[model samples]
Target: MMTNEINKTTGLIHNEGNFVGSAMLFPFNGKLFAITAGHNLYGKKFTDVPNLDNLTVSDHTKITHPIRCILGDSAFAKSHDIVLLELDCKTEISNFLPIRFCTIPRNPKHSLMFRGKYKNTEDPVTHRAITYTSTTTQSEHKFLCQIEKSLLMNHNYSSGSDWLGGWSGSALFIDNHKELICAGVMIEIPNKGNDGQLLFVNTLPLKDLGFESDIINAENLDFDKALNAASLAAIIDSFDEKTIREWEENNKNSEQLKFLNRKLNEIYPPDNIVKNKNKIIKQLLAGKAYLTTELSKNEQIFKQYNSAYKVYNLDSKEFYVNTKAEALTQLSGIKSSYEEYLIGNLGDDLPTADIKLLAIYGVSEWIADCSLDFLKYE
Candidate 1:
């Protein structure tokens, strides 16, 4: 997305008339979240209020809403340098960027941009032609980017504090030729002069924050290309029994490994079974299966399901569902089970982190049969 488009979803965080920092609307699962730098809420500069109840967010429309809850806190921010917030009002997802988590390491070859409000400004300024330097050694979670020199000089800041003071919690996007994928959040400036590099906390950590299956993989953004890349016969013929045996031998004792292996076998069965299941897999991928009717009611859910199926097929080398009827049955059962689980565990007194986790992974049942371990980062 472009800077002007992103500005529609960007907001400013305020505490008692003081401009804390910049924030952007993040759509995950079925909820809208506001993400910003952690220091804005928990840094030494702001000590009076440690929680979100005292905070409010104002977007470009100038409409303000009280924060409903703090899903992630300062402790997480200290390590991750990002804080996740929940707003009390409703917002259209179309106005915001799609939630695609960058899973690979970024380098100078990539085009980048930063969009956020500068000190109490209503409109966000776009900083273009950013250069990716290197990942910071202090933490694997953080990376460094040099701001375009001309843009930096035009701002004319005397010191690092003057340059980066109001820009905390701003968003960093990687332009992938087709669309801009949100890759990081601005956290700090490590140097003292006008040449200081902008330090950012990448979005990969959000998977560990319990958004693994919900966000789309940045690598798999071109769904149409992926769908047309190979035929079903080629996919089935490419399967290597030797490789499967080696993987099983390496992790023979792990129950999780066994489960994953069983699922893999189902995707690449005997020749007779492959002919039958191949039709099912193709129908599922093309959205012609029985579950498509139910999933189509919610566009977001359908998109997520489509992405999950594509990811599993391309990356994991497996397809889990056998038949259209079986998938529909499994989905219905999973929904019922999840509702019962929520009813039995969730209440008025659950911890904030626990509640956040539940909300984040609430849709895991949609892909319950697929292995999600590939979503995690090392």
Candidate 2:
């Protein structure tokens, strides 16, 4: 989405009686408010507090609204550059942008997009760039992301024009083929003539600081919904007698082939549904699933996942795994973990860097090596 198109959800934030930066309007706890960089509200480098009475945000129509309160941790202490301001008055929900929670893309080649108002310009500008993640700090609450210049350099504008001062607190968004999901928020920008890498804080840390998890959960649902829709669309688009014949030849013993054929025929039956292909595709493009209900529940939503093999916990209804382990190994780990939880031994040690690393990266490498060694020629 472009800057001019998203003005309804974007606004200028006035800090301590000055135009400090821009902020994005987001839904927080069933209400709407402006969220901006903590530095903007707490003063440069977080040295002084801004005048709360003078703190304000202006919507697309330039109507100013007073801030009710500021929430979240200190920028320097928590390493979270976010400041969630509670609104003193309610704004029209239609005028604000929809809030979407999403994880930062780990793929370096992934194209990311964000829009922000430039200090020198009247309109907000859109940017499309690839991301480079810098080293994670010890806090793990914040990480620096470098917004590399767009591969398509057809434009004449400078990189600073798209990601400089007055852009802090602007939402960095990515289209998930469903909706515009926010991945991060702008915190700092490189000086002019420097490699214009925009730095921002991922919004995930805010959850630990007491922001509701519901928004993130909804984002996951939207993501899954979009993926399913896209997959179904591709299958429908590629369906044909020749394709069915090829599938039959390739998967003669596959049990799922019959089910796939039945579903395809049901959607594009040679008679009635074929005529409505255009309309169906339009809905699909709008992120509507062909199926009325969810296909399945994905238990593994946490980014702290490390496993390819998941064994469900019958007692807690949770899924846990460390790698592609045999059924016996998985069961043993589950039993130990559950027992620890029962005896209150598990809750004592909060998650540390080692746990986080293990969860995120897994023991897959070691497991693979060991399995190869033990099962060789077996």
Of the candidates shown, which would achieve the greatest lDDT relative to the real structure?
A: 1
Error of 2 at 73 (Å): 5.2
User: lDDT of model 2 at residue 241?
Assistant: 51
Task: Report lDDT per candidate.
Answer: 0.56, 0.52
Candidate 2, superposed: residue stretches over 4 Å from native: 1-5, 73-78, 146-163, 191-193, 215-378
Counted clashes in each candidate structure = 1, 0
**Candidate 2 lDDT tens digits, 183-235:** 67787764542564667677776666577644444234432545444334443
* lDDT value for model 2: 0.52
Whole-model lDDT, model 1: 0.56
Models 1 onward score TM values of: 0.53, 0.52
Model 1 lDDT per residue over 213-297, tens place: 3444443432222221221222334345553344336543255344434433433445544343333233223323113322233
Question: Which residue pairs show collisions in model 1?
Answer: 37-169
